[model samples]
Target: MDDTANDDLDVAAFTTAIEDFNRFYIRLPTLEKLPFTTLSVLDTLAYGDGPMRLTDLARTEQITQPGVTQLVTRLEREGLVERRPDPGDGRVVLVHITEAGRRICRSRHADRTGHLIPLVARLAPEERQAIAEALPALTRLAELGRDRGRAAR
Candidate 1:
């Protein structure tokens, strides 16, 4: 094959591998009580700069405004998140993750890491090293994907 054909094949293979990995990862069991959407909202709130408005959360999470509103209400009732009036805009309400929410997020992260460690350890030394070397590129890829998603929305 010509160089261009080889590169195209490599890109296709990489995309398929990433998609497969994501599918497998999503199927892994966890002790989480919250639905995936709720957990995702908490994760964003926990890691974000500060509280975010409902509209912002909806945009960032790629969900409908009504969906986000319902999720936030549930989270607030569970004491995982609280809404407060935005200081800059009285008409706007911002959602902030509570300490309980942060704890849940941390526990979920630990559980995921625990589940992955054994699988990663099963890899050959060279394969593990290759993954480690690819971390930066993978991170950049994730950032680009996130940016593209936002732009598309």
Candidate 2:
């Protein structure tokens, strides 16, 4: 805990955790060869609870359908994903992670389970509550930032 910045916010802990996460994720050997766009699409699905339609995912990622299509194609070729027809709507295809994709998700997820979750778990009850309460506002800020950035671009 020496030299730990005890600023108004637990900025050091948060920033260190973020930096460590980025460092580990970027260093993963498999990721070295992955296209950022392709990995982003897979990450969107992995971060969520389930598969998504290309259009829906693309919208969430602020990318185009053709970009999603290309990423999906590459992932499919890599055996990391599969395209399935929506049961109720055959015209709409849902992109799902295959076993390999699940494996990748699990491995990548394991990396976070060690660092971020443990530190978060160490927070006092009230502190955790504060974070929970702040989540919505933070999310709104992030959304606004994204929207503004998009508009600016």
Candidate 3:
């Protein structure tokens, strides 16, 4: 085939594969049970080194500042988070995850792993090997994207 035809085929194949992977991943029992936004916010807080500012949370979550505040309020009401004044800046309220939040996060992570492990085990050996070989590059791609996202904000 000509170079143009080859390029078009490559692009289509790449796009389809990404979409398929996302579809399969989001359909997993663990993810399907949680609201995407709640999981996103909880995951962010669980992974962060410390409390985050409301504005930063909004930016990270790609939502409005008020939206994040509202979400935080709801989380606080549910005992999943607590807001405290930043020692460095009394005016800045930092959102921190509560013990309940941490517990839920650990539970969710375990659930996802438990659900995925069986699926991975069921895959043919060759298919599992192929995925393991691709993992490093895929992980690198995710890291690059995360870096770019941080830089953008």
At residue 77, candidate 1 shows an lDDT of 96
Candidate 2 lDDT by residue in tens digits, 36-141: 6666667767765468888777877778889878878888999998999999899999999887777766665676555557778999999899889988976886
Query: Per-residue lDDT tens digits of candidate 1, residues 1-153?
Result: 333566535876787998999898866777786688998899889975569889889988889999999999999999999999999989989899999999998888888898999999999999999999999989998778767755764
Question: TM-score for model 1?
Answer: 0.83
Off by over 4 Å in 1: 1-9, 147-153
Weakest 10 consecutive residues, lDDT, candidate 3? 1-10
Candidate 2: count of backbone clashes, pairs at least 3 residues apart or interchain = 0
What lDDT score belongs to each candidate, Candidate 1 first? 0.86, 0.74, 0.82
Worst 10 residues of 1 by lDDT: 1-10
Residue-level lDDT of model 3, residues 55-124, one tens digit each, is 8889889999888988899999989899999999999999999898888788877877888898899999
Ordered list by lDDT, greatest first: 1, 3, 2
TM-score of each: 0.83, 0.55, 0.79
What is the Cα-based TM-score of model 3? 0.79
